[model samples]
Target chain A: MIAENVAFGIIAAAMALGALGVVRTKNVVHAALYLVVVLAGGAAQFILLGQEFVAWVQVLVYIGAVIVLFLFGIMLTRAPMHPKDSLDNDLRWPAAVTALFLVGILVGLLVHTFHADKIHLNGPVRTADITNDIFTTYIIPFEVVGVLLLGALIGAVVLARKD
Target chain B: MLLNEFLILAAFLFCTGVYGVLARKHAVLVLMSVELMLAGVNINFVAFGAFHNDRIGQVFALFVLTIAAAEVGIGLAIVLLIYRNLHSADLDDVDTMKG
Candidate 1:
């Protein structure tokens, strides 16, 4: 559908621009903020594909927790809000060229994968089915992830605090 | 939405993150770049999950989300401790850890 393609384009453009800001920003906090935008755009793309579970998780976990932790660490460290030290743009040319080349190869591969005949093709997605599968087959790994988070929390606290 | 569009976005995100990691002098920004890359990987997971009509990619993305959260928690804490000792966040200034 025209609507889906357009939505996809808008989201993809936002994702790319946010990512560019992450690379172009001088302020570390600004970079973290740009990453939040990028993460949100990616989550939007996930939602556009009808994967509500993944999209919500992306919003909840990455934007909510990780970036907040990074900000806290930056604040706690007394890092210069905007020090005199210049942000390095030394490899800008080479890196940009590399990124462009990578994009070209990826687009080429996409074209190869989806021929013109498949333009209007689509399949089904069901939230109920995915939920059932997660609660059934993925129960153990899901529980383990919780335990892993606990371990990580304890370890991080131990490593971060000093006597 | 098809998988290829998601793949393209993921690829673009990854390349940008690579560029950021290489270009950023601030250690915190470098960590942000790493998170950008992880977000790309998460997109890939959900994309595949949708295409195959399976929920495993969601599970995988969940796992990745957890790992990324843990990574940032530990990484930032370490950065804070380093800044406490060194009084600077510029990567070039943290040579004490190298030698």
Candidate 2:
């Protein structure tokens, strides 16, 4: 239990710091790299929660595919590698105030809702059970997600192709 | 770790993403921020799913992941298109639709 707590603390700290980097960094490439750190920290949190399959999927999809695509977008668009003052708009102060307010409300609500609850990590939901549920109970949504992905692919090709 | 801890962490991440979305001028960075927000939601889903010992949260998380992937693809494609036409990825510069 102590080990789990320690792991959670460490992962949470990394995630917070990495997210700070993502937003604060001026270079787009640095922001993308920071995003990778945040994404990896998220996967670590999933592993600590004992959802192994989801953890691996998080690593594979977010770290492997998504961030790579972000990097591709960054490079292809020729975002400036050096720090630039123009990376942010004039609404930084307002944005910061709004974000802090949202965070306060969300954290307060979560604490009020689940303050006494403790999640037992021993009884993890297995991959097989998840697959069964997805195939049987959520089959329609699953197929719809498949179609959505196909459409996204075709749309991307069409939108990105040079005329 | 208590459930509140995870919830608080997710909340922090979500707020960070929100700030990024509202403040960043680069369109790709906004997309990255969106990814951060989705990651926070995924954490919440997995945490609740683990808490109840149910498979639904993880299943839903998978669906979220799929949708996020598709979103990034289409979003970045749009970003690329904007860049190709305007030669700029800054969100504020793409005001051609303004009245």
Task: Put down candidate 1 lDDT per residue, B1-73, tens digits, no spaces.
Answer: 5667777788778877877777777778888889888988888888777777667887788789888887887
lDDT (Cα, tens digit) per residue for candidate 2, span B1-99:
798888889989999999999999999999999998999999999899888888788899999999999999999999999999999999999998999
| Model 2, span A1-163: residue lDDT tens | 9999998898889899999999999888889889988989988888888888888998899889998999999999999998556799999999999999999999889888898899877655578877899899999999999999999999999999998
Fraction of native Cα contacts reproduced by each candidate: 0.64, 0.92
Tell me each candidate's TM-score.
0.87, 0.98
Docking band of candidate 2: high
TM-score, candidate 2, is: 0.98
Candidate 2's DockQ is: 0.90
Q: For model 1, what is the error of residue A79's alpha carbon versus the real structure, in angstroms, after optimal superposition?
A: 3.2
Each predicted complex: what DockQ? 0.60, 0.90
lDDT of 1 by residue, A1-163 (tens): 7798899898888888888888886676787788888989988887777778778888988888888887887788665667676676477678778777877887788678763422232444566777787689988988888888888888788877885
Q: Candidate 2: where are CA atoms >4 Å away?
A: none
